[model samples]
Target: MAIYELRTYNVIVGKMSEVVSHYKNEGWPALAKHPQKLVGYFTGDVGAINELIHVWKFDDDADRRAFWAGVYGDAEFMAFAAKIRPLIAQQQNKLMLSAPWGPQP
Candidate 1:
């Protein structure tokens, strides 16, 4: 069974566009170099404003940690993070397990 991670980024006011553009243009590509699996990416439509949400899956906690290690070590990813980090005000992450009776991806 895979573990799912829901990550949310709350951006500073008026900086959502820069964050989204950087992720779309550079972050996603950099992440793809690793073995991590991205389920989806979305922008908040209601409630929380200037928020971005993305879901990822991993075989286990070790797999998740390894994936992050690779990401952090990648020069491209490091540069991308340097650019986007200032745009984000806060971040939230939740680990989830799929219900046995639910449909699996």
Candidate 2:
């Protein structure tokens, strides 16, 4: 079964705009150099403000680990991460599997 990694980053209050700018200008560009694994990215407008969420799908745990290792090890991506790290207050990650019967994406 495919595994989905959900990453939620809580932006430091008042820093969401700057963080988004960096992600758009540098982060996504660097990540796009790697294999396609991203599902999409989301941000909140109502409750849970300042949260940046993105999901990625992988074949299994090894695939997931390998994908991250590649991204984390990349010089360009690391540069973007370094710039954005201080703007994030916290991050939460969860691995999920699709339900037995339902739409899968």
Candidate that would win on lDDT: 2
Per-residue alpha-carbon lDDT of candidate 1 for residues 28-87, written as tens digits (9 for 90 to 100): 899888884789889998897788999998999998888888889999999999999999
| Local distance difference test, candidate 2 | 0.96
> Stretches of candidate 2 above 4 Å error?
none
**RMSD (CA, Å), each prediction:** 1.2, 0.6
Clashing pairs in 2: none
- Model 2 lDDT per residue over 1-105, tens place: 899999999999999999999999999999999999999999977998899999999999999999999999999999999999999999999999999998999
Judge candidate 1 against the unseen true structure and give its global Cα lDDT, from 0 to 1.
Answer: 0.91
Compute each candidate's TM-score over C-alphas. Answer: 0.92, 0.98
The TM-score obtained by model 2 is: 0.98
